[model samples]
Target: MPSSKDAVIASLIKSFEAAPRREQPYPHWYLEHCLPTADVAELTALPFPAPALGGISGKREIHNATRQYFDAANMEKYPACKTLNEALQD
Candidate 1:
């Protein structure tokens, strides 16, 4: 059976190839519907920790304790994160 990551990678490749590409100073593609709506929703609904600023302003390094990331651990935990990471990689 194909894994969800494989399925999402196939969809993302197909969408990117089918979308229009514009090459000017740089080569780029405007990919649309890159991921399924359900997957996108799942990512949005993820309960990532949000640190309170408390009027604090600086780089994210300040709140490293409560910081959230899509690192290997999160990618392994979340299907949508893994799929999205795959889509962005070569």
Candidate 2:
């Protein structure tokens, strides 16, 4: 029997591979039901450190050239963030 992780990976691969794509303007596929509602809620609830802005306007790329939103340290700090990352990668 396939492990739960393997089964999910297989399912995701099948769904993504089977989805129709548009190649005219750009190549993109619209996938659905990839993540569960509860998982989404938990991920969103994770306290990812807010990006520090340079000026009054909330622009991350204004003075800060480095565009590091989800860093490795933060991922280790937050399990939900890591879970979301793993789901996206799968």
Best-performing candidate as measured by lDDT: 1
Candidate 1, residues 15-71, lDDT tens digits: the string is 988999999869989898877777878887888957778888778678788887888
Number of clashing pairs, model 1? 0
Inter-residue clash pairs, candidate 1 = none
Cα-lDDT of candidate 2: 0.59
TM-score of candidate 2 against the unseen true structure: 0.50
User: Best by TM-score, which number?
Assistant: 1
- Deviation in angstroms for 43 in model 1? 0.7
Candidate 1 off by > 4 Å: 1-3, 49-67, 83-90
Off by over 4 Å in 2: 1-11, 48-60, 63-68, 86-90
Question: What is candidate 2's lDDT per residue for 1-88, written digit by digit as tens?
Answer: 1124344455567768888887978999977655555555665676655666645676534746544445677668765556556655
Clashes of each: 0, 0
Q: What number of backbone clashes does candidate 2 have, counting pairs of residues 3 or more apart or in separate chains?
A: 0
